[model samples]
Target: MKAFTDLEVWQRSRVLRNDISQLTKSFPSEEKYRLSDQIIRSSRSVGNNIAEGHGRFHYIDSSRFLITARGSLIETLDHLIVALDEKYITEEIFNKFKGDYETCLRMLNGYITYLRNQQPQKNG
Candidate 1:
């Protein structure tokens, strides 16, 4: 992959973010300031954090950001659960989104492990 955009986790997170954005529009107006806002923020944070981590000069820093991204993914899942409980979304849709987010989480975890296992460059 030539860029952060090429990373599978990043790409999937972007798609998930877009999916959540569109789904939120169907929520009641009252949710605009609550659950909808939360899911949107958390979903977008996943990709944003991943990209930020990719840009970091040190592998440790990248891993840190990846961890944060993973946290955001969890947060997004929490918001989804709330939506499901509130009857804002159907069981089928919730399951699908949750499954996709879980996949992204697994991929992000693998990426983090890879980064942590890498040896730092030695000074010349």
Candidate 2:
């Protein structure tokens, strides 16, 4: 990939981040400092970590960042569950976002596994 933006994981994450931003707008003001803030930050971190990983030269380094990104994605999912419990979002909306997040997680895992399978050549 030429850049992190070229990665399917990053692209999907960017879309989800935007989606969460828009969805959170309907949340009550009380959540503005709590759930809303947390979900937004976690969502943004997913893409940020992917971009950072892409910038790394070593495959291992990149994979490590991707792992971190996956963690952030999971965090975002937890926030979604909380939102659902709080009635900030309906089950349908939560399910949709959950599906998207799960897809991103799987893609990231596949990419990380691919990276791990690579063997760096040593110059003789």
Candidate 3:
């Protein structure tokens, strides 16, 4: 109905970026330029892409950007899983951030579905 910034997905993504920044601080120094950096970059991409898409003039373009944002979110989650497996994070921390990631994913998917259903048909 409104712009992507006004969407719950964007808001949640902003919060997610902040949370990922904080969480990455607890990672081992060896990962400072590796997983930690990647996690932060990927997390930020989610919000950035949404904002960029919101500024686009077409719904299809916006939807495409949101899809890219969702892909980045998935990438970040994969890095989180690796951090957990490598002992960079404890189960408690993993559970907390993992929950947020899952919520973001669900919201992104819902928005994508909504966008697709709203598109008008072409006469071909």
Which has the greatest lDDT? 1
Task: State the lDDT of candidate 2 residue by residue for 1-124, as single tens digits.
Answer: 5977888889999999999999999999999999999999999999999999999989989999999999999999999999999999999999999999989998999999999889576889
Any runs in candidate 2 off by more than 4 Å, and if so which?
121-124
lDDT of 3 by residue, 7-93 (tens): 899999999999999988988899999999999999999999988887888879989999999999999989989999999888998
lDDT of 2 at 17: 100
The residue pairs found clashing in candidate 3 are: none
Q: Indicate the residue-level lDDT of 116 in model 2.
A: 88
| Cα lDDT for residue 15, candidate 3 | 96
User: Candidate 1 versus the native: TM-score?
Assistant: 0.94
**Local lDDT at 54 for model 1:** 93
Local distance difference test, each candidate: 0.95, 0.94, 0.91
Q: Would you give me the overall lDDT of model 3?
A: 0.91
Tens digit per residue, CA lDDT, model 1, 49-118: 9999999988899999999999999999999999999999999999999899889999999999999889
